[model samples]
Target: MKKKPKLLKKNEGLNPAAAAPKIEPIVVPINKALAIRVVLMAGLVVLKT
Candidate 1:
């Protein structure tokens, strides 16, 4: 029973480490999309002027 708890703790620690990479990829694309949208908006404003 003690060993099982230890294994669970180790898995819990690794879970976040594993999940972080997955989350980062998602965030990067979102940032890239936002950047593209900002650039497009700036271009539109400049063209209007």
Candidate 2:
């Protein structure tokens, strides 16, 4: 007879792999860089005048 895998009922912390939350990578858009530079330049121009 084949043996079955033991079920984890009482000890939840025993499984480290399943307990961890999945992390997804967040990416920023490239166009945002240009917008930031424009805003900073406008601030500097206002400050200089």
TM-score attained by model 1? 0.58
Candidate 2 lDDT tens digits, 1-49: 2333334432434655554332212223445777799999999999999
Over 4 Å off, model 1: 1-19
Error of 2 at 34 (Å): 0.4
Per-candidate RMSD, Å:
6.0, 11.3
Error of 1 at 30 (Å): 0.5
The TM-scores, one per candidate, come to 0.58, 0.41
Pairs in steric clash, model 1: none
The parts of candidate 2 lying over 4 Å away from their true place are: 1-28
lDDT of each: 0.88, 0.56
